[model samples]
Target: MNENQKLALVTGANKGIGRAAADQLAALGMTVLIGARDARRGEEAAAAVRAEGGDAYAIVLDVTDPATIEEAARWIEGSYGRLDVLINNAGITGSGRVSPAEAIDQIPSTVDLDMVRAVFETNVFGVIAVTNAMLPLLRRSPAPRIVNVSSGGGSLAIASDPDGPFTGLPTSAAYSPSKTALNALTVQYANELRKEGFLINAAAPGYVATDINNHSGFLTPAQGATVLVRLATLDADGPTAGFFSADGPVPW
Candidate 1:
C-alpha cells in the first residue's frame, strides 16, 4: 500500500450507483472499500474493480447491523490506519420497485409504521452508525470527506411545488421522508465537524435506473454517481452542508 494513497469506503457497493461510485473512485487512484452485506457479492464487486487495475477490497458491512459495522471499523483501522472518504450509499426504499400506482404503500395517511421505521433504520440511522464508527479513522487523514446519498424526492421545496417535476410521482412517506431526515442529519453533522475540516454534504442522485426503482428511471447508474464522486473528491475550500445534484445545488 502506498502511504500517500487515500482510502475510500462506499457502503452497499455491490451494485447500482454505489458500485459505480466505487469504480470511479478506484479509477481516480483511491483505494476503495466495497461495503456489502453479502460477502460473496462484495468480493465479486471488488474483483470487478481489481480487474480494471484499481486497488479495491471487499468489506462485509450491513449498515443496519451493529456487529458488522463495528467489525468493519476495526478491520479498517487495523489495516489502513486511516480513511479519507466515507460515502453513505447503503439504503433501502422500504417498498422495492413499486410503480406509480403501487406507491400506495408509502402514502402518508395509510402508511405502515413498521415500514417507515424500517426505512429510517437503514436510510437515516444506518448513516449515523457508519459515519460515527468511521470518524476516528477519518480524523487521521489530512482531507476527510463524507457524502450522504440522498434523493431529489426528499426535497420539500420540489415535492411541495404543484408545478414541480416530481409532483407527478407518487407520494412516499417511507422512502422520501427518510431521505429528508437523512439530509437534515447531514447538515447537523457538517455543522459539528466544520471546524475540524470535514466536508460533509448530501447528494441527491436523480432518478436512476436501479433495483430500487425497478430500472424504470431514465438516467444510468454512472450518471447518478457523478455528484457523489464530485463531492467525495472536493478540495479543501469546497462547500459543505449543502445538497447538490449533478447539475448544481438542489433546493432544500
Candidate 2:
C-alpha cells in the first residue's frame, strides 16, 4: 500500500451494509479490508469490489472469534503496518424476523439467555474485542477513525417517547439492547481516544433491506451505508462521541 493511501477494515463485509461500506470506502481511495467469518464469502465480496475498480481484499475475520480477531490484527500489522480507519460493522439481530409477532422470540419476558448472549457476543462484545485488538495498529496512524454501526432502535430517547417512530416497531430484547450497549461503548471509547486525534462514533443506519431483517426494510444497503462511509472518512474536525444517522445527530 502507498504511504499516503488510507487502509480501512470493515467487519462483516461479505454482504449487506458492511459490503456496501467497503465498496464505498475503496471508491474513496482507501484500501478496504473486507472482514468476514467465511473465507469464500469474503473473497467473493472482495472480488466484486475489485471488479468495480475498488481497492479491496478479503480478510477472514469473525468478530465473535478471538483467534480470528487476533490473527487479523497481526496480519494487518504485517501487511500495512497501521490502520487508518476501523469500521465495526459486523452484527446480528439474533432471530430471523423482527415483526411484532415474530419479535416474541426475543421479548424480554421469556427470551432465552443463550439467545441474548449470542446477540451480544456479535453485536456488542465482538466490537470490543476487535477494537482492542486493532488499537495498537490504529495508534500508529496520524489520524485514526472508528465507526461503530449502531441502530435507531437502540435510542432510548426515541423509545421512551410515546409518539416516536420506533414505537411502532416490534420490541426486541436481544438486538435492540445490544445496540444500546454498543452506543454506550462508543461514547466511552471516543472519550478515551479523543485527545489522540481519533474520531470514534456510532452510526445508526436507518432500517435497510438486508438479510438481518428478511428484507422487510425499505432502504437499500447502499443507502444504509452512506452514513457509515461518511463517518469513516470524516475530517479532523468531524464530531466524535456522538451518535449520527444520515439525517443528523441521533437522539441519545
Q: Write the per-residue lDDT of candidate 2 for residues 1-252, one digit (tens) a residue.
A: 699999999999999999999989998899999999999999999999999999999999999889999999999999999999999999887886544445768878888889999999999999999999999999999989999999987899987788987666567889889989999999999999999999999999897888867888889999999999999989999999999999999998
User: Could you say which candidate leads in lDDT?
Assistant: 1
Give per-model TM-scores: 0.98, 0.97
Candidate 2's displacement at residue 94, Å, is 0.9
How many clashes does each candidate structure show, in the order listed?
0, 0
Distance from true location, Cα of 1 in model 1, Å: 2.3
Off by over 4 Å in 1: 98-101
Model 1 lDDT tens row, 116-214:
999999999999999999999999999999999998888899989999876676788898898899999999999999999999999988888898777
Q: What's model 2's lDDT at 207?
A: 76
The lowest-lDDT stretch of 10 consecutive residues in candidate 1 is 95-104
RMSD of 1: 1.0
